[model samples]
Target chain A: MITVRCFATVREILGCETRTLPPSSTPQLASDILRIVAGARTTDLPKPLLVAINCEHASLTSPVKDGDEIAFFPPVSGG
Target chain B: MIIRLQTADFDPEREAQALDVKGAGARVSFVGTVRDTAQDRRIEALEIEHYPEMTRAELARIGTAAQTTHDLLEVLIIHRYGRLQSHERIVLVTVWSAHRAGAFAGCQAIVDALKTRAPFWKKEISPEGAVWVPGQTPQDLR
Candidate 1:
């Protein structure tokens, strides 16, 4: 199982904080999981989006596997 | 080093007093507050959202980086989430070092890195409506 999470503006765009997907046999990348989770709203996501796998920063090309929690978020704006 | 994320407001004076500043020759504290206006629009409040574990880890990373880079003796970072009214403190970074220069640099480094690195977002609640503040990329990242 892979759990996908969204934060900040990305959360607002995705309309959900977390979603868990069933296990997949085929090899999947971060982009694939993001595309699968985002569905048709992929283009609506905020620009310069960031990805994290298992709580560490990652890129779209990063691999995804069962038990990994992937996160998509807008660039951080904090102080 | 100390790091905290809380919904309750903090008293900087109390926090400073609690720290063991005995050995340090210099101590610097920075407090970030919610502004009454954002981008020319008057705001009623600022809503801060942060990823639970990720935010903590990132803040720790920033604090450690500052400590190493600036030779800081001690560091403290306190960030608040949820809705905060104008003028309310949003974050606090305090550093102690053998000299003023290290303390100053360490505090600034933490603040600068936290602005772009920490996984926190601010939304402006205005009379018009709520809007997510736009994201900013550090010059080096671009």
Candidate 2:
């Protein structure tokens, strides 16, 4: 299973805070996971949406593995 | 190095005085407070959200990098999250060093890095509505 989390506006738009996806067709990368989560709402995602794997800031192309945690969110604005 | 991610407010004077300074001849501190307005909109509050584990790690990275680049004695970073009213304190950064230059530069470097590198999101609640700040990490870091 791949653990997926969303935060900030992304969470608000998706209406989901967390989700679990069983490995199917092997979603091999962070972008793949995003595609699944986005579904038909691709256009709603942030233009420069951010991704993180296992709590470290990462890119969409970062590889994914079973049981890994993935996060999607808008750009950070904190100081 | 000391890093704190808390929902409670902190006193800058108390935090600065609490640092264990030995040979430090200078101490520099920075406090960030929420503004009452953004652009022309009257801001009501700021809602801050963060990835817990990542926030700490990124802060540590920034603190350590600042220390590496300067001659420092101590580093302390306190960042508050959750709903905050306008004019409330949002963050504090303090650094102690042997000279004024190192202390000043180190503190500035930490604050600059924190602004872009930390995994924190802020939403401004104004009279109009709540909106997320459209800031992102640089392309290389993302």
Candidate 3:
């Protein structure tokens, strides 16, 4: 199993802190997870949201192993 | 070995104090503050968002990577969440190394990695509307 975390606007929009998905899920990579979460939160998923796995930015094809942690967030403006 | 995600204000001195290690000769620090203007828009405030578990893990991983790449002794990273006004310190990074170059390089790498890697996002609230800024590119994220 993998733990999915939503943050910032994504968290507020989703109304949950974390969600657990089976090892085999759609959009398996961390980026894909963001897409799924974004889709679930807003009627139309924003194109610019960011995704990270284990604190490192990951592409949509980055494979996620079992017990891996994933986080999804929008763009950042902090210095 | 300290990682924090808080909405409360942070003290760089205190954060620096935490980086005290026996073997390190130099300590380099980086503070990320909230800027007033973004994309030429008169800024008001910033809303910072991050994933909890994933953020911590990602930061730790980045710290580890920095340690591996550079001859660093210790590292400290602090990131704030929630509403923040302009000029507020949003993130703090401290690195201890045997030499200044290592510390500086490690610190820079950490901050750069954080920008592109960490699951943190920011939204600028201005007179016009709220817009999400594009994050680091995939190459930059790495």
**DockQ scores of all models, one per candidate:** 0.75, 0.71, 0.38
lDDT of 3 by residue, B10-128 (tens): 99988798555988889988988887998799778888776666678878988999998998888889899888888888999999988999999999998987876676678888899
Q: Give the TM-score of candidate 1.
A: 0.95
Isolated chain A: TM-score per model? 0.94, 0.91, 0.71
In terms of TM-score, which candidate is stronger, 2 or 3?
A: 2
- Each prediction's RMSD to truth: 1.5, 1.6, 4.0
Q: For each candidate, what is the lDDT?
A: 0.89, 0.89, 0.76
Ranking by DockQ: 1, 2, 3
User: How badly does each model clash, as a count of residue pairs?
Assistant: 0, 0, 4
State the weakest 10-residue window (summed lDDT) of model 3 chain A: A40-49
**CAPRI-style quality class for the chain A–B interface of candidate 1:** medium
What tens-digit string does per-residue lDDT give for candidate 2 at B75-141? 9999999999999999999999999999999999998888787888898999899988887674466
- Scored against the true structure, residue B48 in model 3 reaches a CA lDDT of 77
TM-score of 2: 0.94
**Candidate 3 clash pair list:** A54-B58, A55-B58, A75-B122, A76-B122
Whose lDDT is higher: candidate 1's or candidate 3's?
A: 1
What stretches of model 1 exceed 4 Å from their correct place? B138-141
